[model samples]
Target: MWIVLMAESYDRLKKRAQNRRSDAEEAAKYIFDIPEDMLSDLSDDDDDNDPDFLSPEDLDDVDANTEPSDDYSVETPPSSHQQQPEPTASTGKSKKKLKVQEKFGWRKVEIKKVDLSWKGEPRQVPGILETPLKYFQKFFDDELLELIVEQSNLFALQTEGCNLCLTVEELKVFMSIILLLGVIKVPYYRMHWEAATRYPKISDKMGRQRFAKIKRFLHFNDNSKAKKSGEQGFDKLYKIRPVLGHIRSKFLEVTPEENHSIDEQMILSRGEAA
Candidate 1:
């Protein structure tokens, strides 16, 4: 247990082993580089009393503060007369920080994050969600539009608030004129659409509340299971989305003779995850 507690981690041990191997190789290279003359100069026959060697009297100042060693190797303490000057506060701190940086060898790196914030321009790349909505103009067929109006009017009558009590035929006429107003602009606002139809202008002529009611309650697919099972994500699109999946499946089933390019798109928004 004690040995296990004191044992170094695998990474530390591997690093230490690599360092030892590198140091040994470096020392071997240095030893091989040494000339024969330098090795021969270190003879054991040299006398301590030789005039060329340093005498005890000459080392009296150095040895005064240090104890005499048993071996021939001399260990001299730093001399009091040759003491280094005390470093200033600023200089000491700078020198210490520099030394720490060099020893650890860590570089300060700055990483800039991707700016996903929509700029409403070419600045940020645009996707299907971010681009101008062109669904109404692109896939709005007469049959689909008529069915949407019929179903929406039925839902509006059943809904508690923002109800549009118009019949299927009246709603069809209303939707047709309203859609035409997109292409042919008129200053009459809601009355422009009402006057184009045979319906009387006695009631509210397609007001904002009725418009919102149609938008909220509109459905193309059966969502009874989805509503009961608490479905989410693309399943929620079933409530308000047309039969777009069937259209996609039809296109997939057919083989194209011509080649076309399609761009990839991602929907990114507040609290919306893909």
Candidate 2:
């Protein structure tokens, strides 16, 4: 009796499961049907006569890939812009497309020059030295000039190879040769300098090597011992700082007349170089 009861219960469960599956499948399946009123304007008397038009019964098999009805119509309001299609679309296609145009507008900005005139009285510097010769003396006095010579000798000694090896007297002769070179048009051939020049009274000439040595090691001041101003980008000529300072002082000391003049000219066939 118990076995029979179990069999009956199993059958009831199977029947219940089948009913639930049917309910779920019915929920998933849907259909959208257009109301006759909405498609009223799409109706045509000639639709029945159209060769490719299908009846409502045939529409139920639309999922089977039925061809679209040639007489299918949508209600589009008449627009004047719609043009008559050309013969190309008589083979059945949309021949025309509409295009929209875009426009751009730009606004320009103004630019003005920056002002650079002085705002107030310029800061003044205190005067120190007087004459240009005195300024030159301040940097190249007897003791400093002697030191310059000695330093040059030390450098010549340390010079690589045997170049410019010279005694003190030879160095003096070299300095003399360089001094005459400023006023003489003699090219730096050793024989040209040592040769008898136009001025026979002038005495003593040296070889070019000594002169070249002096030129190489010559400096207005000892570069290693030079001082620096605290300002950034401050570049006074390192070799000629003393002379520059003196020249600057000479200008600062001058009390120019209210009426000033400026002149620029060439001397001895040289303009900018001169």
Candidate 3:
């Protein structure tokens, strides 16, 4: 009787152990066998807050059964954050749908070539392309030089209470020295007149002191008659207005060929060019 009772207890224990193991295995299978839609929802919930994360729709998954069309086409999916445009009543189509349906059609057309030959005169004013000085003087004539002299002398008298008596010939020499300095650059204007680095062409034509005085008193327009800054009739380039006007008049007189181009690279410095 004792042996039978012990065997019955042993069998009950074994049965309980098998039942617990079976329950555990079934629970594990239930966890792994979740529905596809439920798994997708869980994944979307996890990534909804993440902006950088791409949703399933953004991915291009071509169907294996689909065949290629004769016309090449690509449809890009809109971002998750982008709002959908409302459909218009007249067209019965949304702007996005219209954009997707838009096609670029090409058709055969006839084109004609036109002649582009020069018919105008070779030279507007027939004259020899002579010396450089003559070419320069053609633009900066005696009239322009006289105007400079008059203005400079008048400015000197007004400011210094003394006659500058600036002649056109002297003004021309002063201008020549200025142009020469641009070509043969030095650290300072005084260096050109210095004994160690004396340029005779500049120093011999005009003394350093005289050049400085002329430069100081030089004017293109009357200061008293000019409007001040913030005034009603103020001109930004008032001081150089007369000079600019004269130069512009001269520029208007010039006639170029049909294919003429003005190269402005020469005026720009290295810093400006960059």
Candidate 4:
């Protein structure tokens, strides 16, 4: 009886061992049969605690997919902090008001009408006989007239400020040359030699060289003259010596009535004769 009992017990123990082995083999087979994607997902979950496991691309994708919370507010860029003001009808009116205020200022001028017609020659008049105020009122607005007056006054002040260091003879020679050039209406190269020969102060060689320098200062080259002619012929017409003389006579305190008369003659000769 004891021997039979031992054999049964041994058999039972062997069967239990075999069953445990079979169960272990079945579980391993099931695990191996799982899809590669499921296995990868399980491996990723296992590596969640590891900081080095996630790649930069993976982290970027995660950040991109995540949405901001409702409670969180993003800070605006410095450039976008200020809001732009919109243009409106009220603003337009304000701009017009500002322009008017800028033009007239607080003080106003009282203008009176006067007849200026005379039987005498206009050239003999002491001052500009025509009422500049009336002319301005007719041709332009008060604002425009104010601007013109301001600019003219400024130009007068500037011209009067220059000190001419030339001797009386040199001044006479310069004026005579300018007048001759105006009368003949010839280019500087042709007239310069003749003028220099006529005037004892100017040598022929010096006159020629000075002519080139003066032309350069006046921007009388082909290209600049052509460009200026296309616009208004301003460059060709604005000779520096004549302009300086006029400005000096009109604005300078040292200039007498004789100088003014000479300037008037020069103006007439250039404008009417030339």
Candidate 5:
């Protein structure tokens, strides 16, 4: 009799468990917006099978993965430009996401202006009212011009085995032509000497061939001793580094304006652009 009663109690417990599982599964199907494929995965004919049973954790995971409904209230935080939906009391997953966003989202509230005082005295150039050439000579002195002439002749001798005979006066005339070329746009350098588009100021100053030769061999620094790429002390502006250093030193001689702007353009003849 005792064994029969134990069997009856076990059957009753099994029936109650099956009924509870059926109600929970039915609620999950309606409450959660799960796909038909997922619903198939969750379904099982045998309620006693442990592996096929869906736990509370499985339901939470499925709920988290499902998309939110369209009935939630829209909210805008005081600091955020974007509008977000306010999670209803039932949406614990949305509340967690909102918390995460609130933790990380930050922005600048206000900015203050800062005033800087100049410590150096104002600079004055004596006789700056003189000719523009005199003021220009302050930067491009005779020593710099002589160095150019030396480099040009040396480069020509080393590479082409010919005498450039590039004198300081000839170099000055060459410089004038270069400045004038900037003002008068021409597609080709030889175009300036063409009869149809000839300028006496440019054509009569120097022969076309001489100008071409000087331009081809002009050097500010010795290329023979320049450091190669990937080597220590290699300079990107190896050709004009000496001239740049000289100009930098000259710039230090005069004080700069408290408020001024400098715009620069570099044109490369041959090799990579810096």
Candidate 6:
């Protein structure tokens, strides 16, 4: 009876174990079978018709054996939803520099008499009396003399009057002096001295002051005109004045021998007279 009982118990345990094994297998099949169909559907969606589809075989050329390289990169194309930047406008316009105008005038003056015998005389003919004659004779046939006269007149008009006021004849004389200096490329003071020496009637101090005033007026007028014309106003006006002053000083310093000659001649004449 005991042996039979033991055999019955063993049979029950084996049967229970077999039942558990069968349940586990069924559960595994239930889980795996559903995923298999889902996998198949995913594979079908990865065909050429799908723009985002890419196969593992396609990526096989990307060396699996080697470490990945960041040197070369793949970027997604810019989408229609993305915004781009616009260009800016240009502004670099330039203005032209102006040309300085010629300013001076001339007129024909009748000679009352010709002193032919005075040519070889110790008392030389004054430059005032000689210059026009020489110019008229040299450029008589050419238009140069007429042009000179016109320019002189224009200059007189441009710079007329004492800093206070100027008469027409005084203005003409001022213009003539400016032209003479310019032609010879001399300074205002030197030109003033020349004119004073030529015409003993003109006082030295008066001529000097006149030239200084004229220079200041010209400089101020030029700057004002440029400003009024909507041009680049004289940015260098202050600097230019100092430079012009230095130039004037240097010019006066030049030709020391010629400058001293007149003084030396006067001194020697005085000594001889004494």
Candidate closest to the true structure, highest TM-score: 5
Per-residue lDDT of candidate 6, residues 1-274 (tens digit): 9788667865765676677643433333343444544454544444768887766666785556568588988888755445533434455685444553444467798979966443332543346655674543442222423333343444455667323343344544555665565555534345445644443333332475775554444321232233433456634454245345544665575333312233334234445454
TM-score (C-alpha, index-matched) for candidate 4: 0.19
Once fitted onto the true fold, the runs of candidate 4 whose alpha carbons sit more than 4 angstroms away are 1-172, 191-206, 218-274
TM-score each candidate.
0.29, 0.30, 0.54, 0.19, 0.55, 0.20
What is the per-residue lDDT of model 2 for residues 1-274, given as tens digits with 9 covering 90 to 100?
9788667866765676677643322222211234545445444545777889986668877857776677987778745466544333333465544443433457796878888565555545548647865654554445545555665655555554334444455545555555565676555444354555433322336445545666787644555564578756555676666556655665776554434487765346644564
Tens digit of per-residue lDDT, candidate 3, span 1-274: 9788667866765676677643333333343555555454454455668887764455444454458896998889976456667454445553333343333567898878878788876866557667989888878899888888889898998888989888999999999999999999989988999999999999999999999989888888888899888999999888888888888899888775777776666655668444
Error of 2 at 69 (Å): 53
**Model 6: ten consecutive residues of lowest lDDT:** 218-227
Deviation in angstroms for 213 in model 2? Answer: 1.8
For candidate 4, the clash count comes to 0
lDDT for each residue of candidate 4 in 144-221, tens digit (9 for 90 to 100): 334333433344344454222323343334444555566655444354466443533344324655444333332111
Worst 10 residues of 4 by lDDT: 216-225
Screening candidate 3 with a backbone cut-off below 3 angstroms (N, C-alpha, C), the clashing residue pairs are none
- Where is model 2 more than 4 Å wrong at Cα? 1-144, 150-176, 189-191, 194-205, 222-236, 246-274
Alpha-carbon RMSD to native, per candidate: 24.4, 30.5, 18.6, 26.9, 18.6, 30.3
- Give the best candidate by lDDT: 5
**Could you give the candidate ranking by lDDT, starting with the highest?**
5, 3, 2, 1, 6, 4
Q: Write the per-residue lDDT of candidate 1 for residues 158-226, one digit (tens) a residue.
A: 555455554555555456556655766656544443646423342245554565455567655443334
Model 3 spans > 4 angstroms off: 1-119, 124-127, 265-274
Better of 5 and 6 by lDDT: 5
